[model samples]
Target: MLYPPLHHWLLGAVGEGRLNWLMLLLAAPVQFGPGLRFYRTGWAALRHRSPDMNTLVMLGTSAAFAYSLAVTLAPQLFPAGSRHVYFEASAVVITLILLGKLFEAIAKGRSSEAMRTLLQLQPATARVQRGAQVQEVPVDAVRLGDLVLVRSGERLPVDGEVVEGRSYVDESMLSGESVPVLKESGANVTGGTVNGTGAFTFRATGVGADMALSRIIRMVEDAQSSRPPIQGLADRVVADFVPLVLAIALVTFLAWLLVGGEAALTNALIHAVAVLIIACPCAMGLATPVSIMVGSGRAAQMGVLFRSGAALEELGEAQVVALDKTGTVTQGQPEVTDVFVDRGWSVVDGEQHLLRLAAAAEASSEHPLARAIERAAAPSPITRQPPSRRSLATAFAPSWTATRLRSARRGSWRG
Candidate 1:
């Protein structure tokens, strides 16, 4: 329908019937060109005894175009008051439906961003130990049981069991634990986890598609392709809706033809076409599948992977969701917040004295709590005297002594 101002302006400028031929010429190609898809699919659906939304669109637009063509080509057949053309109605409906399809395609393209991001996580190469020599090779070239050497501050190339040495691994990406996990001999390590400041060699146990990262990517792909259970209900209703609308349109045509007086033919055709056009099932057919795909993909992007489409649908039914406290609510990194000093010391800078000693004692430790203590004492002006690593066998020693100078402490304690 035209807006009030535009309708009034058009009528004032051109009167009436002056632009009907131009409209008919502009609409003819659109009615038969890309619109051919509707006719082909609609005819197939009707032949199979299961008419669908395509059939309804085809019938509605074709009826409107046929009647408008009749009116435009031979206006004298109808009474002077009933002669009218509706080329715009038929053409506009096809254009709008095509535009909706284009938008749906664009949404499908955008939903794959999560999968692309997941694929980007896997490293391209790995360092493998060959007999007495170490060589770098493609990740896929490393075989099971091959000894893979990983240095400090690097991502693990594949899932494997440690063969020698010790380190702490940050598995927060997969396990949601902020604290770095200890990886001693025989301990298992996963691909994509970052290693702490220690070197280690591990036997490759899972590579290529069998790696944990690859399996997670596969789960995301499966979840995106799967159809949720709710889509079945929509499919059933749409199957029945087309036939119900066709029956109503037939009844409307018969009622108008028998009861309407001089304008019975025009009245029947117009009302019947209106019922079919308004009952198009484009939205009903598209809503369920598109929502499922987009929802699953967006969830993966947010670090929440749905196992399947059913999980995505069932998520709405949950009343209480249990979440991990470390990674979900707080940053996994630990930092010292408060410290208290012993009462009997009577030292002016007792807190700084204790913090410097604590930081030196923990300087060789790889634990997160030790790092937090070190960070807290970093501002103290005193030179930290850390114990020898050769003497300290374990990261957390029961009792270790570090000599502190009283002169270095007088500058400032900024903790």
Candidate 2:
């Protein structure tokens, strides 16, 4: 097609004197075919007295094509020394522009994939119970107050309150918390959260467009569509840039022709064409997209993810960053220095069970405090039926008390 093959052929055909006929053939298809899009847009801009990068590109390529065609057809009009054709210059510029836009599209797609990954977090289907009969249904079919059964390790498809059973839910995707939050009867649960090793039944409180996940997706889309503050400056520059470039090109043409003697006409046209090509709106127009793309790419590499292109742009202006003290600035090498248990728990002597539960709870945490708890509980050597480690410390820090924290942080205990 005009995309992949056009660039390859044009690049290789550059400076090939013997293939002028083939170059002419290839160049004709480009200027008349894909190049027509630029001409139409450029001509419209000209008619309206508003030129753009398209105008610059169109004028440059057109001049190159016309000059080369004239040289090819009427060799007698020019001396043998001035008989140079630039079919490659015109074709290659368009091909390069196409190539740049293609790469830009691919980059933007990748940048926006964070939202796709988030959307995929919601389960495609849910086990819903209506009276005595339970049936599998698409997540969209789930309605408010419906009894949705979330199995161990399954994702909850709707925001709801737990009606029966107990489980730990992983809300990392939604809130960036590395630990799973515990859920029991009367506790509210969110959609897109991963159920821990325990199954649970919850009455759906929010469904369809009202769900937390749906809201998140909508916010991300809105952010993506929103323009950054700097976009105003870029727009203003683009508004006047084309006309200014045209003036410069005209001055360059006149200057060369008026100053040079014998080869002034040919020299003037070359300077004017050079001005047009050099001033192509590519870089100026790309200021915003390129910055956003580059910012996204660089941030992603550093384990930082942005919600959208607009967010990335706005982040550049942020003078302060908030981070967790236990892990962000320090070595995060917390050690469980003291263990405090409640009086009732002490009377029962539940240290063995305590250690097992503690070990399982803190394993999923990236923070140093959780690591300390995990380390202290690892030596307990007790086992239970939870199947694997849990992220309870980082998970329950917001709601669970110190006693509950110690109980879950000591060992791999389960009921």
Candidate 3:
């Protein structure tokens, strides 16, 4: 493109002969350097009698570059207007295709982020009770029936049943529930779920790969690897599509050569190269796999894991999507929307006083409702009192014990 414009600027500073050599110098690296992969794959496919998108790219770009090189080296063989170089054509095509593959690579890397995040959810160590001694051991060392101890604000190491303690467990990781579920003796608790403001001892029933979190991660990975039916059909079509395009290009080259016209050789080669370039099957070969991998990965990021690529493809045809209200619509967190106090209770600060008392009572608990009350009373002045004999008695005593205050409290709740 700079040939005519820049050449006319300095009264033909660079002659056409030198400019042609310059084009060859610049385009040689682009044709063989980064574009070598296409040549190797395309040749291998051809020798195996199975042509693909790479074959089309190799044939088209090679034909254009060869014709241009010949024109530049020996311009006397062709007419004046016929002696044109296509260095930009070959270079641009290869650059664009390589850039596209780079973007596809980036998308593939992004798709694995969700899987990495899910893998991080599993704790590396578990607190196991062994003959009256509680020891922290690698989670992989934990065996079925082992007693696992989970404390407040800790994630369960494996699926188990509560054998000896009472607590509220935040199972929102699996169930998407806004409120923590109460766990007691014989209640089943899953791994990866967080414990509330109480401690509990449970017998591990599912360890290692058998855990629910592991199964979920495996499902997401399988979905990413599984091929959709449409991709198989596309592969079949592309297998035949390449040969058909080659046949068409050959027919075009023959027809143009045999017809009576000026510069018939040049026209035949140009038309055939055009046919090859226009018939590239890159979209057909790349579209299905790229979409499946990217869509499944993005869905996993949004907490929607598919079982297989076919399921992901079918999801596109879904007209109505049903979603649960709690986590899906509302954020799955509780808030104190309103305060209700009885007229019989004598309170100096009204709603603020009631909220402060409630926050103090539930301060030791980690349940969603307790957190909500605490947030409501955060702006008000709080009186932090050390644990006294009377307050300790009130904390442990069943009369003053609120249902949400299951955790052991070390301070007084007389705010």
**Model 3: per-residue Cα lDDT at residue 149:** 93
TM-score of each: 0.79, 0.69, 0.74
How does candidate 1 fare on TM-score? 0.79
Q: Write the per-residue lDDT of candidate 1 for residues 62-150, one digit (tens) a residue.
A: 87788777777877776676676777877887776676566445544544566676666667889999999999999989999999999
Find the number of clashing residue pairs for candidate 1: 0
Candidate 2 lDDT for residue 201: 97
* Most accurate candidate by lDDT: 3
Off by over 4 Å in 3: 2-12, 223-237, 261-263, 281-317, 336-415
Best prediction by TM-score? 1
Candidate 2 stretches greater than 4 Å from native: 1-19, 79-81, 220-235, 255-267, 282-294, 297-305, 314-320, 324-375, 378-415
lDDT, each prediction: 0.76, 0.72, 0.77
**Angstrom error at residue 371, model 3:** 5.3
Error of 3 at 227 (Å): 5.5
What tens-digit string does per-residue lDDT give for candidate 3 at 263-291? 78877887887787667555554565467
lDDT, candidate 2, 81-162, per-residue tens:
7777778788877776666556556555664676687788888999999999999999989988999998878989899999
